[model samples]
Target: MKVLLLVAALVVVGGGIGLVLVMKSAAGPEKQATKVETGDCVQLTGAGKEADAVKAACDNPQTPYVVSVKGTVKGDCPEGFYSYSVATPLRGEGVGLCLGINAQVGLCFDDIKTKTPPPLVNCSGARLKISEVFDKASYVNSPCKEGTEEVISYTAYGATQKFKSATICFVKP
Candidate 1:
């Protein structure tokens, strides 16, 4: 419900573009990003299944997906989660990262379900506006925002049941 400022740095690598978010905070000093783990945010290179994911600043509007379970098999992402595989220079094989929507309050998104990482869009005429997000099994009632048309949420069982995260996403009314 307060103002948060995002600070990122752009780095060019061999004609490709990469962004690193150095600091992020809300009404306070900037917080540094030092590590990557589950529940962290990621920036995708494209909207396809093969899109590469790089750790980005959490709560960033540009970073559409949040890491739900890292180090899992590719294509093992639970419902609402996407699978992204990355190759490490040191390893012969690729690593898998499961991601879900990085839905933040007040941010708007378009093509939420149709795209791998839904495109971020202007709030005006946007398809969805995040009012609040809740981890599954943690909430008891709907908390959608007033005048909201829908509560975005889902649950599904995967092949191996690696890590199924069902988030109760809704707006606070």
Candidate 2:
């Protein structure tokens, strides 16, 4: 009987320990903070500036994410309220390059009646695939007008790696 009791106790303890280990492993990688994904863009904060950040954000590099760009586009406002594509900047590493996305810019009218803004797409948390290249970069631009506002966003993985860092900026018309 004593031997039977000992065996039961051992089995229970082992089961508990096994359960704990399984839970921990299922949690996957640890992220400092939650990443935010909008249909057009993925933003990650607190990740390292390069490869480390890319890996941490993606948690999986095999998935490709489609990025959307929005904001006040430059040039005369469209016949009605509409958004257009700007230009995509080069993807490489160059210290002290130009500021702001090189693509077209968008402008939001403070007082205008139009279709309600569309739902923001969640494109965050995608992995940036990195080759063995040393430095890479990409650029995007917002349009400009005399009295317009420019806000832009780009969604892509490995941005922090190729560009060494990714930044979102507003250009005042």
Candidate 3:
């Protein structure tokens, strides 16, 4: 009986340890705060020139800006806030010009081809909403949001043949 009790206790302890490991794995890695870099992708928290901006994964569907140019901006970006340059300057020595990405979300392909793309806007009150965002391989399998009316996808071509490509999904309400 004593031997049986010892075996049972060992089994229980082993099971507990296994459970802890599984839970830790499921929680995922913690994200660390990092500085924005040139060619990095970012998302703005609010409207206006002084809005807070956060670095994001380039493929992140929520990301609206793609760092196009980074340097000590001379006077003002010729195009102004809506231009390639961000409305406000970034921290550190130089400013980063973030070109708007996925701005063609709501409009049809023909519309996109004819007209110039618009500036990035916050998610709320946007005519075009991102229902699901994924890479080229996973886009077809990704699910759409409940009220999504239309689905559209955009692909960003890289400069080099070896560059990895990304795809974004947008929905019109």
Candidate 4:
């Protein structure tokens, strides 16, 4: 009787442990505890669809883009960092992507009359300048390099209040 009881207990405990291990493995990727900081490399997922941005190692080839700035506003990216914004079709919450400075990326004009946004290109070594328009508060708060010329300005509406956002375009010098 003692031997049978011991065997049964061991089996139950072992089965429970195995079940836990399997569950953890099935939970998908583990959530990142650390907040994404400046200069960290990230991969933008679901492009041209729904955006699901996540942090990735700098050397990871899958994550080619770097975080130049961290904020909720758009078009307020620091000089040299390309700013791109993605919003749901219904104008729900939007996410911003601040590509690394001097990183070869494409450009899309907000005013471009098109059913979809333009494709990205390798605009490296191009004679381009930055044009930005954002909320005054955001502009004043962000740590953008000084002497950034502001070509145009406009009001940006968000899901909630009419918060300001900017559209900084790179043009030929």
> Model 3, 49-155: lDDT tens per residue?
44444677765656655543344444332221223323333333334343434332432221222122244455555555544554442346445556655443333
| Over 4 Å off, model 4 | 31-35, 45-120, 124-169
* Candidate 4 Cα RMSD after full superposition onto the native fold (Å): 10.4
lDDT by residue for model 2 over 100-137, one digit each (tens)? 12221121123222322222122242121111111122
- Alpha-carbon error at 19 in model 4, in Å? 1.6
Mark the regions of model 1 whose C-alpha exceeds 4 Å error after superposition: 1-35, 46-51, 87-90, 135-141, 153-173
lDDT accuracy of residue 106 in candidate 1? 70
Error of 1 at 118 (Å): 1.5
TM-score of 4: 0.36
What are the runs in model 2 whose C-alpha is more than 4 Å off?
A: 34-169
**lDDT of model 3 at residue 165?**
33
Q: How many residue-pair clashes does candidate 1 contain?
A: 3
Q: Each prediction's TM-score against the native?
A: 0.55, 0.25, 0.34, 0.36
Q: What TM-score does prediction 3 earn?
A: 0.34
Candidate 1 structure quality by residue, lDDT tens digits, 1-173 = 12222222222342243222221221122111113467677776633333356778776777766776777334576555566665432223445776677766776775555424566677887777776665553334555445655565644346654333444343322
- Deviation in Å, model 4, residue 85 alpha carbon: 14
lDDT of each: 0.54, 0.29, 0.45, 0.45
Write the number of the candidate with greater lDDT, choosing between 1 and 3: 1
Q: List the residue pairs that clash in candidate 3.
A: none
